[model samples]
Target: MPNDHYEAEQSVISGPKGKVRADSIQFFKFDGKSEVDPQKLAKDLEQLRAAVRQVPDVDPDERDRAVAALLAAQDAATEGDEVKVRANLKRVGKWVLNVAESIGVGVAIAVLRQVVASG
Candidate 1:
């Protein structure tokens, strides 16, 4: 396994008169392409699915949709099609972020954002 780290910084201005400002900085760890293993990827995706399912205050329908997206991503990975795998993963990441944000799971949302953006 290859351990690679990346950092991202973001700033936002909102609210009336644009007086409110928010900033966020995050560090993400990426799995190296050369080190990718299908079995490991499947396991990791399952873990992420479980985490999403465990989030509190999440709509059941939303959670089911997110899990379905993850399963599709896993199927894509099993086929060893890099393009399809990336596409499905991107879909899964987006759904994950949506669910996370709905339930106020800030950490998961930030992590998913980094994963989706980095890819």
Candidate 2:
């Protein structure tokens, strides 16, 4: 693992010892700048927000929750907070994955993934 070139857009901890309890882990940040294009991510997040709004099966409350997640994702992207953006996007995706194809949500999320991948 080369710290200088490591782009950990996602991470997972597994195995028997991976059971992380609250206050059991210590985290630290490396002073590395992100290569992701914040503007591109923000644009796709906006599209995702629109797509979420058009989900016919989602009730008003659910739609609102999804949109809130998108907005948080957008904000995080603008600030180059990749982890937060992905977490928020996951929240939105979980809220509407079943109806993804019914609207443009699937496409929107895919585009966002591309933006992050190439950023």
TM-score of each: 0.49, 0.54
Candidate 2 lDDT, tens digit per residue, 1-119?
23334344343354444554443332212124433456665876676677778877867887998899889978987786766766676665454544444455443455344333333
Q: Which ten residues in a row have the lowest lDDT in candidate 1?
A: 7-16
The digit string of per-residue lDDT tens for model 1 on 19-117 reads 643254433323344445655556666667777888677678877777887777667656655455555656664657665566654433454575576
After TM-score superposition, the amount by which residue 95's alpha carbon in candidate 2 deviates from its true location, in angstroms, is 6.2
lDDT of 1 at 38: 57
Give the whole-model CA lDDT for all candidates, comma-separated. 0.58, 0.59
Candidate 1 TM-score over all chains jointly: 0.49
User: What lDDT score goes with residue 105 in model 1?
Assistant: 42
Give the runs in model 2 whose Cα sits over 4 Å from its true position.
Answer: 1-11, 14-36, 94-119
Q: What's model 2's TM-score? A: 0.54
- Model 1 clash pairs are none
- Candidate 2, clashing residue pairs? none
